[model samples]
Target: MKKVSKVFYITVVLVILAVAFGAAFPDQFEEITGNIKTFVATNFGWYYMLLMSAMVIFSIIIALSPYGKIRLGKDHERPDFSTATWIAMLFSAGMGIGLVFYGAAEPLFHYAVDAPTSEEGTGAAFKEGLSYAYFHWGLHVWAMYAITALALAFFQFRKEEPGLISATLKPLFGNKMNGPLGVLIDVLAVFATVFGVATSLGFGAVQINGGLNHLFGIEIGFTAQFMIILVVTILFLASAWSGLSKGIKYLSNTNMVLAVILLIVVLIVGPTLLILNMFTETFGLYLQHILEMSFRTAPLEGDNRSWLDGWTIFYWAWWISWAPFVGMFIARVSRGRTIREFITGVLIIPTLFVSVWFAAFGTTAGDVQNSGIDLTQYKTELVLFNMFDNLPLSLILSIIAILLIASFFITSADSATFVLGMQSTNGSLTPPNNVKVAWGVAQSAVALILLYVGGLTAIQNTIIIAALPFSFVMILMVIALFKALSKEVKSGK
Candidate 1:
């Protein structure tokens, strides 16, 4: 009989038990998760802000340092994929569904609340809304991803270590990285990745269900959302089985094309001049306030502190939770690229795309609201479809948007399953089929349970709570990576 790896079975069993317990005791689970989430946000919100700012600054410094010239792989090796395909896969894995989910809703929500430093529904409010959207989806999150991916790539390729998160820290912990500590690190990573991806899957299903409800008048409820998860889980499991080169790459490229088409249609059909102006002004505002916004915590805003916890702090935690899956996937595809190239692509390209995406959908939605469209009655998940209702070919565009969401969901899940398999199977670059299938099922099961428990609030709380520990792990990874890089430079690599 083939000997099964202990990490694989241990992680699987632990996750299964946790999900089963949560499902069986839904109220208790929610209470616990909610309390933990609040505690972390209230106490550690400043830590998250400072850590994210440091990550952003660290990534830039590394990219500009002399070590930037070092290739992720061997000295003479070239990139595995072309630039366009690489960027597509990066964006697809990093924040595809999130961009679609928040592009319209977040800006409108910010506008309604009169988000910090602006009055409600005014021109400044619109710009502030887009600026906050940009801040949430901008370079800082990408910097978190880039730093993790860089560490994984450098250790796995340059130093010939296994592609495990703990392996990147061998410089600090030495042989202990191969023992219980390493197993613990990998297990926490598995937990974070599974929950993070499941939360995303749940969010995507909700929006897809909302789109369907708007298009065909289907009732929006748990039944419909579960069905969406079931279908997407099957689709992505098959994609995971097809492996990365065929399934993930193809879906990512297709998603990029569809997203671009939707973007162009919206820009042409909606208020073009308004979107252009908003993009220009918001881009400028984002640049001007990037540093300020990066460190903003509501120390003096009384009850408004909850706003920071919900939006900005929640986003940072969400991104950190997602870093394991996204970072591993990016590392898997990023062999042979230089550190500078990887950081630049991961940080700049996707941030630019997100800015354009937000400017298009966000500004259009803001315009609709300003023109007396009452969007307050709709759920946040349904906001995009509601925005579409006011545009040309509403039905057709809604369907197209639904398809885009589905495609993004599959791509994200597909990559996540592959990464989970790798993390569980001792960092195999190509994890086995059965392992992939197992992760696929596990992810869907968790999403289904969270959906049944408390819908979006449960999912958000789960992500925030789950990401707290992993954020500290990421800080350790940065230190380990820097230590390793210094040695590499001294050795004249």
Candidate 2:
């Protein structure tokens, strides 16, 4: 077997000890992490909002600047994947299961259950619900991702640096990044990736369990979700075993097809006109109030402040936690493209796709609730299935939804295993399978531990805690990348 770096052994041991602690003292683990998570959210909610907003602005300026012409690779190089395939791969790896997991649930939550500012189940809430959904899942999420990916791709491909997050900062830190500081940076990234992907894995298990319960009367509980995670862990591990290009590529393209089918079916079978109407109106409102929402701390209103802490703040942390994994995976596949094209495509394509996705599923959900279906009666994980219950071909739609979630579940874990393996192995493009297996198991174990501790809330808590330190690393990465880009322009290389 190949010699794995010290980083691999260190991260594996850390993940194991953390898992053991969570397993041995689940309540204590949950309470401690939960308290820390709340403290971070309360004290640093403004920081989350401001940092995310700044990243979005940074993404736009770089795409429009003269540096936009700089290719990710050598100037003569071209993109590795076709445009459509590239988009599918990035979108699938970026936000696949999230769209299914929250498509109907998030907007509907804001609309009927606990709206941001408006009275629940009112016209005002309806608009605000979808608008907030767009706000959360749209431009900023991708911008956070785009900035991280841009830094990695620029440093790794253009400058011929190692494909590590630490390597991206070498412009500012120089060879010091190759010392203890670099190892610490990579470890934090792995820590964030492990907990972050584990959090998504928890959601996937819950939603899959929710779908099974909704479809076949299976009980929705930790046992069932545990089983769901167990089965998925085996499957995605197999996908990881199959290596990256063949199975993962096929899966990514298939995800897009299935997602498109689901979206069109829902729009056509459900309230098509209403879906279009909400999409147009809410999209406008999302753009109109984006600045307000971007910096909104809601210091005055207790109810809205609580809502910000719960949703907006949580999402910012979630994206930051996800940045390392998603950013690395994206940079891996985004070679040979110009910075402008990369940022614009990574930014716009998914933004438009998810905006329409929310419109179709969320508007239909709101319509269902308006028709007196009481979607609020269902759990968040089960809301989508129940919402489909009031629509045409509900059974088939639910089936497709489950399959999509499972596919995304496998693809996400598969990609994370690859990313973890690379990060731990000094940025090996094809890391040893043994290292991948270690990461794959560790990820699943962490997911199971989180579910055992407190289910979705626990998952949220872990990611929030993991994202904070990495957020600081990302701040430095932006500075390093800017320094490198300026040097590039000056050298005329």
Q: Which stretches of candidate 1 lie over 4 Å from their true place?
A: 1-4
Candidate 1 structure, TM-score to reference: 0.98
lDDT of 2 by residue, 1-493 (tens): 1457777878888999999999999999999999999899989999999999999999999999998999999999999999998998889888978899999999999998899999988998999999999999999999999999999999889888878999999988889989999999999999999999998999999999999998899998889988998899899888899988876788899899999999999999999988998899999999999999999998884657888988999999999999999999999999999999999999999999999999999999999989978888888899999998888899999999999999999999999999988888888888898889889999999999999988898898999999999999999999998889999999998
Error of 2 at 366 (Å): 0.6
Relative to the unseen true structure, what is the C-alpha lDDT of residue 44 in candidate 2, on a scale of 0 to 100?
Answer: 93
Tens-digit lDDT string for candidate 1 (178-241): 9999988998898999999998999999999999998888899999998999999999999999
Error of 2 at 167 (Å): 0.2
